[model samples]
Target: MTTATPHLLPGTEIAIESLPKVSLHDHLDGGLRPQTIIELADAIGLELPATDAAALGAWFAEKSDSGSLVEYLKTFDVTTAVMQTREGLERVAREFVLDLAADGVVWGEIRWAPEQHLTRGLSLDETVEAVQAGLDAGVEEARGAGHRIRVGQLVSAMRHADRGREIAELALRHRDRGVVGFDIAGAEAGFPAGRMRDAFDLLAASFFPATVHAGEADGLESIRGALLDGRALRLGHGVRLLEDITLTEEGGSTIATLGPVAEWVKDRQIALETSPSSNLQTGAIAAWGDAMVDHPLDLFYQLGFRVTVNTDNRLMSATTLSRELALVAEAFAYDLDDLLALQLNAAQAAFLPVEDREALMDTLIDGFEGAL
Candidate 1:
């Protein structure tokens, strides 16, 4: 089910979509298919801005490109509206995985805030169960279709909500079932990771891992809070971490100096889950410039930081993981080796046992070698 028009690596016939991929920062609510949204909305007696699938899809892409996170987030209202019921959630989750499989995502961590879907009498645990059920079905469907794919849930809590502790507990309850990790996502400006100290304390004490949404809508302090307070092993949309590095031109060569925060992230190999198209859309990389080439991800990669490419919201950005990689490859002049390196970075940073990670690396290496 790959796209008819392949997203190829620049100057090569290899379709990027055929490459094995690991997606670290995809949102569940943000990746629904347009026709699915329309059908789900119709079932719930919900009115949409557009009844046509293509038109509705265009609306989301248009609204998301507003270059303001808050404004961009407003599009979620339509998507989330149709996802309140168990049937809606299950269908959306199933389709999400199938889509990922078609795009060559071998492993993906799908994240969403349970609290947002509680308005229709579904408890947090119930919602998690529903999504897991759908994910399990999706995995089976993919396997039956001759695709090698796996997915895990990363339960997230909305930062604007005061239910951090509650959401953390919910995630822990289902840790053995399907949930792999926890996250705090929403507006990252006023709601620093420190606001959820008690929740992080609980997770830290229990040896649970978390990735905080930082260095995107906010700046260095937000990233500092994510690392120091949230105990984040990964920084979600951490594009702005580049601000900590001072760049200089010397003797016709560029030299970069890492500030304390940058040093800690780089030294510790904290994975930066960067989304190139979404970063430009949400203005996450505005300080650098307004194009894909201006994204700090290439700089981070060149600087030896654990840089991983992701499609933050495929529907919103009108992109796929393959398209994101192709865009980065085109912008940064990356070849197959560079693309493999980024996927290896993602596999290494995955929330899996060390043995599993090593196996994943081997899978990636085999896939790349076979492609060559």
Candidate 2:
């Protein structure tokens, strides 16, 4: 499914890859290039299931498509294994940006847990600095290539671990650098955001923004903790929040009622970073259905919620932001206006200053207008 050149949508005769986009929930460890993974593994004397790039790429997709979160997460072990050193982190970060720029991403936020990459004797601060250096290099390279892209790091803490406070402090220490926000990621079923209340309190005290991973593997209660306890500004793949919305058939029309949790999220316009492909693979939307058309994205959009499209794990999902947009467009018959709305939603929710967000909005508008 990998291509050397851009792919075009069949009927529209438009190159979706050429449209400017924003990526909000992308993962650093989950987006490593297959070729880079092979090379890194070789350097570390690690063995992989497939030595060839194409086969290794296929392996990741197969593992992720098993429809089990446990199976899906196993692929990350391979990717993160090679990302334990400064060189590996820098290379992966730089190439990740390059790939995003090539896919017409104008702005993106790359999230990863710093604590996960410290196995090779690198300090948390060193890991962040190395990733920042790589991101800076990639931005400059993209600029030189006439592709303007800006990326910020959203430092994440593993929910199953006890380093939320340490990771929150790490993010704040690098706030003036490339770090923009904080997040808690990992299995969300058993580990509630309330367990990390101290870290969230520290972040709230420091006035740092956060976007917690909730409502994916869990239900409404996890989302509740994310909002009330974690104080998350955004909900990563908050697709399961739909459980709080009750659809009633009355008078030949289906009426949807939002529970308090869903109401708060919708009323506050907390952006839902919905990744259709990844959601399907991980069964995040299994309650709704197994197809893209069955995703609650349309319902969320129709309800006036901030529903932004995202490619959560490009490598595992074997997808790009443009491909994701195309899938949703095909499923819901979204026109150019819908695409622009999603991009605008992401721009507005970005963890950037008002001036920077406005500047990004201008660029997105100009890009869409030019595409038209």
Using TM-score as the measure, the top candidate is 1
* Ten-residue stretch with the least lDDT total in model 1: 1-10
lDDT of 1 by residue, 1-372 (tens): 125688999999999988999999999999999999989988889999999988988899999998899998899998898889899889889999999999999999999999999789998899999999999999999999999998999999899989999999999999999999999998999999999999999999989889999999999999999999999999998989988999999999999999999999999999999999999999998888999999999999999999999989999998999999999999999999999999999999999889989988998999988898
lDDT of each: 0.93, 0.92
Model 2 TM-score? 0.98
Q: Which parts of model 2 are misplaced by more than 4 Å?
A: 5-10
Question: What is the Å distance of residue 98 in model 1 from its true position?
Answer: 0.3
- Candidate 1 local lDDT, residue 273: 98
- Clash pairs, candidate 1, are none
For each candidate in turn, give its C-alpha RMSD to the true structure in angstroms: 0.9, 1.2
The residue-by-residue lDDT of candidate 2 on 104-219, one tens digit each, is 99999999999999899999999999999999999999889999899999999999999989999999999999999999998888999998999999999999999999999999
Model 2 worst lDDT window (10 residues): 1-10
